[model samples]
Target chain A: MARKLLLEHAQVPGINTYEVYRKHGGYRSVEKALKTMSPDEVVDEVKKSGLRGRGGAGFPTGMKWSFLAKPEGVPRYLVCNADESEPGTFKDRYLMEKIPHLLVEGMITSSYALGANTSYIYIRGEYSWILFILEKAIAEAYANGWLGKNIQGSGYDLDLYVNIGGGAYICGEETALIESLEGKRGNPRIKPPFPAVKGLWQCPTVVNNVETIAAVVPIVNDGGEEYAKIGIGKSTGTKLISASGNINKPGVYEIEMNISVEEFIYSDEWCGGIKNGKKLKACVPGGSSVPILPHFLVCKTANGDTRMMTYESLADGGFATGSMLGSGGFIVYDEDQCIVRNTWNFARFYAHESCGQCSPCREGTGWMEKVLHRLEHGGGKMSDIDLLVDVAKKIEGNTICPLGDAAAWPVSAAIRHFREEFEWHVNDPKAAMERNYGLVNEKVNA
Target chain B: MPKVTIDGQTIEVAEGTTILNAARQIGGELVPPAMCYYSTLKGSGGKCRTCLVRVTKGSEKDPRPMPKLVASCQTMVMDGMEVASKSDPSVVDARAAVTEFLLINHPLDCPICDQAGECHLQDLAFEHGKSNTRYEFERRTFEKIDIGPYIKLHMTRCIMCFRCVFTAQQLCPERVHGIIHRGDHAEISTFIEKSIDSEFSGNVIDVCPVGALTDRTFRFKSRVWFLNPMDAHRDCPTCSGKAVVWMYGGEIYRVTARKDKYGEVHDFICNTCRFHTKEKGSWTIEGPRDLDRHSVISQNHYEHGEKTVR
Candidate 1:
């Protein structure tokens, strides 16, 4: 069994409260950070810990913090990205609902390190219950003097507030979230004046994921080198993976990054294998946006090396046979599930959620959805298979935001790996309408 | 000043000049077609994605190439940056794809539309788009609405360029309409169907790149190709009154702001001069407006002195 850094006391009675969390050694990182370490020292420790963001992008958090432009007399900010609206990813909600103080503590320590006098936690609007839990924990922290002006007489002033989004998936993007925070429509701003330089009302800001900010507590509580020693090379420290779909025990699990993918799937401590003794067909190891890997490549790399639950191991084959460990939303598909229907469903989500700012994502996503819908139903042509690929390629790299790529990758990967399934639909639309292609090993040579 | 290269043509521009503006400096075929970017309107570009150019080398300091094609309207040029616009086959292909995306939902009703001859989208499609569309789905449509007494809102042809919204905000004291909803369902709408009554609201018709917003007084009056656009102006208390009056034989059809080659108006005309004062006696006509020989509006226009208008 691996050590649990985040969820060790998740099952403890009243761990959501400030008293029980403090008894379990919470806020010690805040004290250690504010009283003993300078802001630059704290930043140095985070940089040494090799901690990448647990967000989908997996950028190094330390480098992201260092990029916050510090012009004198101007206020800097640390924004917690609690807008966990990605499909198949609910680990942030689970962490906040289970232990809210950890995130509040992280916000304090991270705000101190960034020299931000004020901070905000932009949470998803759908998590209203979790918002209640977090607010309760934040009130408790303020009552206990862990938050607010000059915490523990350390001469550092901080104030943290929580703001909820209006239930849009694009708000999870940093600039869109900042726009929503400023009481405007959630259209993503064009880049080059990144949020690190000018964000949140033209102030320098750093937006970190919920888990990435929470991990700063552990990096400060223990030394950076000690935390770095827990996981594989470069994928240091533990991660919270929100496991769902076709699994026996579907829940969030904390795994040190050294574990193998097969062990995590079949071991009783984790997902406990596929449901109902069914054979595994495919899996989207990351969230819905990442490429879907076939069953053969799920447990081992294309070179036959055992794939581990790390950033480098999962992305070893670079979209040919490999996938990313994106947001750790491990989704498993059994033999009975249809890949074409799933791809269409995701396309519909992207089309519906597109902010309509850019042309490609605005029109191309809906066009792909209509084509995929036609292919899934009985109204598809033989030429529609290549047409889908062409449309997805056109939209991939030509948009103002990454939403275009996210909408394009699933369709491209679905046809790349599961071309046979789509061809089966096109070859015999009547049969596809009646039944699904179940667990075929080889192509039908249509 | 920053020096940049577009399609192997090198030019030095003022510091903070965008790549699209830089391409315009070396004019002719090098300037990429821009539908949403109007230099006069603030925060108008980057949504259309028609002017995307590849940066082969990022800059002198960071010589690494940008991984993806960037919207040239929003990105500023770093010194020694090399951009590939028409020179790269990928940019041409990308512009075609973007043209298709813009046309898929757009109702291509150029024959009956008032802005047909002067429409930017019509020219963009003729140059960069495929002859036939591959989209089999039903094109989206909306009802014609009268946004004001002077302007008609044809929602079906709007590409969501947001130029009109910027025009209202920057020129009008109170903007009554804006883009509402989101995604493909997004539309420029007034709250609770309120009519736009601003004094300067007629300018929205000029800023529209398509026939989405047409002049209500000039609706279905005549095709722009048949009218001769002459440079004309009048002195008014509210606005500059500098405008181009579209004239037929002894009749003034419509009056609009004098637009530059890029279809941008430097001085905005008020509603009184645009709609109410369309008469030959009210203004001094300053010859025929110079039209680009390549434009559809200049098809039968005698550039010498409107000799054919008997």
Candidate 2:
């Protein structure tokens, strides 16, 4: 894939400082867009560029800006969704840790374009050090003419603040993020009046993922049409995936959309192949929340179509057969891994994480966890497999937000693709437990 | 108003009402079965799935629905929507499976539980669950982790739904519940290493979908059914909501968490409030007080006969 021109200066020394950033052509996009181009033209440019959200939803960036309800006499705000709590996804952490100025430049440009005078980055509470770096960077940007007042004489002002979350996975949901920003618990509000309508403080708001905002500086500098020419249609632009779990090179990688699932697995550029060259067993292509895809199905859809690593392609067969690009948390499992145990572990997470407000999710997540754990621990009977499926089905589409569905995907998918593994556990519980249960749990606890 | 048919009975309801909430509109109950539902819990679980009711007509997806049942907790009542919840055989089957699934992890600790007689699981099982389960598997167990100073851990009894977490966090974000495990063995744990020491911690005991999360203060205190519930202010004085304080022999035995018009509009003392009975009503009243004393200042002149219960 062609390394887009903007991300080249990302990892260099002094790149975090405002001076070095300026020397390497930083904030020029803000100058160009603010001084020369109309905000509408910028929105149109991003739309034409086919830049989708890099924050895992894969929504079009410009299109999302366009969706902002243009409420008059109200202070429109920009919220950089930096609550990167998805397990195994840490690409945003690396970017903020290494290149704070890049994100600052992007925030300035994106904020100016959206007519947002004030912006808040709702960062995860665990990233306090990252928050400190951002504060220092913000102070530095102010010291230079890059931030406050007329930036490079463009007659625009932007102020940024870091709002830390109180530790919630649901805050990744935009409204929840807004609620957390307002210093409240991060329960997602009902939609229809989306964040763009009545968001943070009941004002117009634009909540973009951190990478989604970081990608904006490039969109402004390179121009939308130029950026559009780079990636495939629909799944436009490059995505930063945090690939981890039983892989040769377990880290972050920036890959363009439309890469084949086969190549991403085999190529050293992403996961560097499964650990010890073990045959692949199953994969949760989009964080722990997306559906689990077996090796065979991960390579191709149920209709024998090869699956590509893109928003549209991966989700081609719908949720039953397809998985979402949520949070780009690619988790791969080796052939020796037990699907039942893995599914059980995920149930435990959902059950534990469930806010317990909604009954189906609260009770169902626990029920699913218990059943899955029971099945995995060799106490499962044949009827237990069906019971697991039934529990997952109950929680699939019920509850306040998509978190319920997220919790159900792995269980339902595991049962759908590997019901035999569950049955095997029922047939011989002790063997299954001794075979797949990892002793590393001791390591994890210790 | 849109006319809808529920279990062969037609009724008109306002637009955009949920079938569960709509069934509530038809007055009296319709033999409803639910393992994971509590209107006070904010959003419905739709998890225990005991609330499954077949939709025979009025929905496009399942026009010729047979054994197909949608969770009434989730599916909204629509115009001309036809539902069969009263006598749907599939509903019974689904509820049975839900009961069985819930039992897979239910500890034998219920005999010692304060929620025993009032537990929804016990009730749902009586209504639709099988007496004998073939699940001879070892129950998934987690060493006790305190959710709050007031609430005790028996994680083995926890279902991992986040009603307690939401209450904890929504009241005070940093001091709430968290999911510790992944997949089947996952559990809701506290983020900090400290004991679940939040003021809202006691709410977990009442909001818990199962026995996993229990109140240290109330657990093993008394059988829930035997206690009388009375409605009054969340006596925590700092909190809002019509408190549901259960009393036996003029002593507060237990308190079922409640969210009234006040608490829902603004989530506060429902957090750090200490609910207690300020005064007693006439002795003619039965078990448990589920009243809002603030609103009963004029109801049947009951306040005039108030006794010093506290």
List clash counts for every candidate, in order: 0, 58
lDDT accuracy of residue A156 in candidate 1: 83
* Positional deviation of residue A53's Cα in model 1 after best superposition, in angstroms: 1.1
Chain B TM-score for each model? 0.95, 0.76
The TM-score of the first chain in every model comes to 0.97, 0.94
Task: Report the C-alpha displacement of residue B157, candidate 2, in angstroms.
Answer: 11
Fnat measured on candidate 1 = 0.79
Query: Top TM-score: which candidate number?
Result: 1
- Candidate 2 lDDT tens digits, B1-310: 7676887777888777777767866744463554455565565445545677877885544455533467676666766778888677766665666566667667857678665655556656655667686455577787876554566777777655555656666555465466554434656777754666555556666666557767665667776656666654533444554456667777766555554421221233343433333234412233344433222211334344755211
Top candidate on DockQ is 1
TM-score of predicted model 2?
0.70
Ten-residue region with minimum lDDT total, candidate 2 chain B: B291-300
**Number of the top candidate by lDDT?**
1
Q: What lDDT would candidate 2 get against the real structure?
A: 0.71
lDDT of 2 at A197: 88
A90-149 in candidate 2: lDDT tens per residue?
Answer: 888988887888888888888877899999888998898899989889999888887888
